[model samples]
Target: MIFCIKLPGGLIKWCRVINFKESASGENPGNLKTPSCFLPSSKEPVRFNLYTDFIPLQKIVTNPNLSL
Candidate 1:
């Protein structure tokens, strides 16, 4: 998934969130602080909304068990 954090001065930066692995590549995971930088291909898709100016959008409920 993609996590986008909006800065105080209207600056938006996005990061790819993923599960933490003890050994991503048998290398010291501690050395690699940013795991997203070494993600494999075919990752989840992320969209950059053109009209959203740090405004929250209404959640769409598709599942019958979901609620607002």
Candidate 2:
């Protein structure tokens, strides 16, 4: 899975999911693992649960008035 995060400076960070960890408790049941940066960079991937540090991005409908 691809995760995109918008920084405070209006920069978007794109990362690829590396692994997943399962949990029995907590608001987020599972965690997603992703690299801190893309390849060619030397940062290790980190694990974060959904709804905590990040959430799934949903499709935006810019034209609600426009007919499909």
Candidate 3:
């Protein structure tokens, strides 16, 4: 699954998710993970639950009025 984070000032970021079972069984750990620059600090972690299918990149790129 891909995750899109809406940051302050309306910036968008995307990342692909890796299930732990897949990673534990030796899937490409680095490839499936979010880039280090996208991660929050350990001292003030951000957390949330995903409840919907991922938003497609095309929709985001093509539409100017969509809001999460």
Which candidate's lDDT is highest?
3
Q: How accurate is candidate 2 locally (lDDT)?
A: 0.43
Worst 10 residues of 1 by lDDT: 47-56
Candidate 3 C-alpha lDDT tens digits along 30-62? 533532222342234333333233466678788
Off by over 4 Å in 1: 20-68
Write candidate 2's Cα lDDT for 1-68 as tens digits.
Answer: 56675545676776664343223233343332322234223254444444354433441255445442
Q: lDDT value for candidate 1?
A: 0.42
Q: Each candidate: how many clashes?
A: 0, 0, 0
Better of 2 and 3 by lDDT: 3
* TM-score of structure candidate 1: 0.25
**TM-score computed on alpha carbons, candidate 2:** 0.31
Q: Pick the candidate with the highest TM-score.
A: 2
Tens digits of per-residue lDDT for model 1 on 6-58? 54557675655443243346466563443342223325444333223223344
What do the candidate models score in CA lDDT, each in turn? 0.42, 0.43, 0.48
After superposition, the stretches of candidate 2 with alpha carbons farther than 4 Å from their true spots are 20-47, 50-68
Clashing residue pairs in candidate 3 (N, C-alpha, C atoms within 3 angstroms): none
User: What is the TM-score ranking, best to worst?
Assistant: 2, 3, 1
RMSD of each: 13.0, 9.5, 9.0
Better by TM-score, candidate 3 or 2: 2
